[model samples]
Target: MENNNFLLKINNLKTYFYLDEGILKAVDGVSFKIEKEKVLGLVGESGCGKSVTAQSILRIVPPPGKVEGKILLHQKNGSAKKEPLDLAKLDPQGKKIRSIRGKEIAMIFQEPMTSFSPLHTIGNQIMEAILLHQNVNKQEARVLAIDMLDKVGMSNPHRRIDEYPHQLSGGMRQRGMIAMALSCNPSILIADEPTTALDVTVQAQILELMKDLQAKFGMSIIYITHNLGVIAEMSEEVAVMYLGRIVEYASVDDIFDSPLHPYTKALLKSIPKVGKKAKVRLDSIKGTVPLPLDLPPGCSFYARCGQAKEGICNKDTPPLLEAKEKHWVRCFLYT
Candidate 1:
């Protein structure tokens, strides 16, 4: 059943790449929802399928990566198609997905330079998305793109739109990227580590800009990052992923205050806390993350888990179950 309140619900999603060595499960049975106008945080260490999950939703998983299960986008009230659209079912390069990609959902990549073409002006790139999605001409799209640049706090939006990606500073390039993503008025914005390339001051400004835009446009955000501090500030709910699966799902306050999974607890401990002794080293999770080429039969996190029981935890994988009200965890301890 489609919930009216949620904008998107990804059900039992699994994205796997069939490599020469073995099948690499990038996202294994991950499920989550984008609640209306809510900022949903997907946080984990690198190579934990955070980016792959976002790509799966947009149906942009590269060749040889097979994505199974439904990525349902629940339509807003009184929209053209009342029924929910399954994005995973659509052809990646087809017109249907293309129509939805920028118009209904847009993404801001980690590095703006990767997305921005050096061959074209910033305005040309921004206007491309607008012109592709909206029923507007080149002139109208240019006007809209310039207005979006201004909205994202790009200094001298009019003049800077003509500048190349290299011409602008890191922060400015990011702002231009944001301008392009918002040009089509997308309902959901997937930000994949969008601030990591910039300095802390620029990072704060970009975050604040996103918050303001989300409110102004009533947009739902899927924020993927390893920074817990950013998650705490921006997310109402968080999904803590481990080894390609969500190990814990809860409110931000619950995650920080009452982490149930051992992995979740360890992750919190690893963060540098206020008033810590200057001489002490920051805590870190022991044991390097195992390769995902051929997954173990038991829990994927079993090897690195501190509280693992030899028989129970290593024997089988634990399903993500509700350990408490609105708090779900996957671990033998909770089971």
Candidate 2:
């Protein structure tokens, strides 16, 4: 049975890709729960599986990749009964998953241009999703799409809706992407590096728009980004990932004030302080990431961690343990 408190629960998810050389474990035994109507930030470096985990939830992982374990969506039935659906079991291309993908859980992909078709206008793409999910005709869907575009702060939405994606500026296109994702009023939104390509001014505006829309829409958000600054500003809870595993999970204040895991500490230290002296070199996390195919035994971060003990840290993989009230960390020191 699904709990009313959680919107989605991911349990020990493992997404692996079969390659000619070896199997690459992109997401290895990651687990977490998204609370209802809250923002959960997934932060990590590139190739740390933040994006793959989001794709796995929607069963959209690319070919040669296998998604295992449970992705339970706590959905309500017509009679007010609860039925937990394991999204991993649903056929990716089937009608059921397709209906649930955009209607219940929407995604704002990293690149709007790639996600949209250049041949069609933004209105067509947004209205297509609305027509597929909602009980609306083409004309009504177009109205709804334009309304959504306006809500996301698109200027001259009626005029812009007919314009092709290339005709719009980068920020306008990003807002259009948000409009497309939110057109159906999904319960959950997955934003994968939503502001990565925008300038600082535009990025702040987009962030504000997202935050405002999240409250108005009453949706839980899975915000995946490499920028800790953005995470601090937008998220209520924070999950720090490394090499496909969540090493630290805590409240935003806890993550910033007192990070427990060695990796999390190193990451926070690498950030340049606002008041620091000029010409001071920022501290960087030492050691390169281990190859996914040939991950070392025991703790994967053993080599990079400065506080690692030879035998203890390299002997066994540490489990994600709750060390404090509502604070979890995966490390030998905490274990």
Candidate 3:
């Protein structure tokens, strides 16, 4: 029974890292909502806490990383009285969060090689995930793993399944990761740059595969990526992150067509277009992203935002305000 209402609602999520220098606010008061079968693109440059936000949802933040705020999850039942669970309040190592981890929500990491154990076979890993989540025999789990491998477009599924992580190519490894993540048919999937290390063609294939799986399973997705191209391809909604906060959030069409925030506009302009003349210099967002521990007090993007209004953007932090229906921007210009 799928609930058409919001499957996940994250309000004021703050995941801070306790560094020797000071506290690094990785995810600072972030908020978003996702329906049952939609993709939310979490886009930003490196160190913007895109991955941290996803990890926080899964309560997978490493030691010294303190998380705060609410992560509300609404379980889909065949009734109007579906209960929403606050995932943030749950103990980090408790069984409640663990119960939902792979059974209802699963995460596919950025680097599949690092995610998988070197000593374990691909078959063993996928089977383990299946057996842990469901009451199935080893043979049944093995069959499920092979079926998932086939579904993910891995050729020679059985043979590939028996192989170690080192034996597969980068794209194949990513497919294996996807297979494992989707084995349990989770309601929500968090893909942390699933296509980062692949070639353009392979990346397209993976994106298409994810979309196909989403359509098949009706699963909501939170895709974290630095690549705007990938976000535009796979996401329905987009949240542009800067430093550790969301600077802009809107539908994908709105974002690429009429980006409100300066950072979002700069990201769109940075992309190289086809037939735009050879040797033309690419436009880049000026300046580098500041370190997390030493973020600017006002808008984190003030240093690089071309449309930043004089002192207004540098002195006071801007609140994320509703610019239009479903479009939100956090900038003095919008405020």
In model 2, which runs have C-alpha deviations exceeding 4 angstroms? 1-4, 76-81, 272-283
Cand. 2 TM to true fold? 0.94
The alpha-carbon lDDT assigned to residue 61 of candidate 3 equals 94
The alpha-carbon deviation from the true structure for residue 20 of candidate 3, after best TM-score superposition, in angstroms, is: 1.8
How far is each candidate from the true structure, as Cα RMSD in Å?
3.2, 3.3, 3.6
| lDDT (Cα, tens digit) per residue for candidate 3, span 143-210 | 99999999999999989999999999999999999999999989999998887777767777899999
Error of 1 at 76 (Å): 5.0
Writing each residue's lDDT as its tens digit, candidate 2 over 19-64 gives 9979999999999899778999998777789999999999999989
In candidate 1, what are the lDDT values of residues 247-321, reduced to their tens digit? 999999999999999888887876533223211132555676666887767888888887889988888999999
Task: Flag the better candidate by TM-score, 1 or 3.
Answer: 1
TM match of model 3 to true structure? 0.93
- In model 1, how large is the Cα lDDT of residue 6? 68
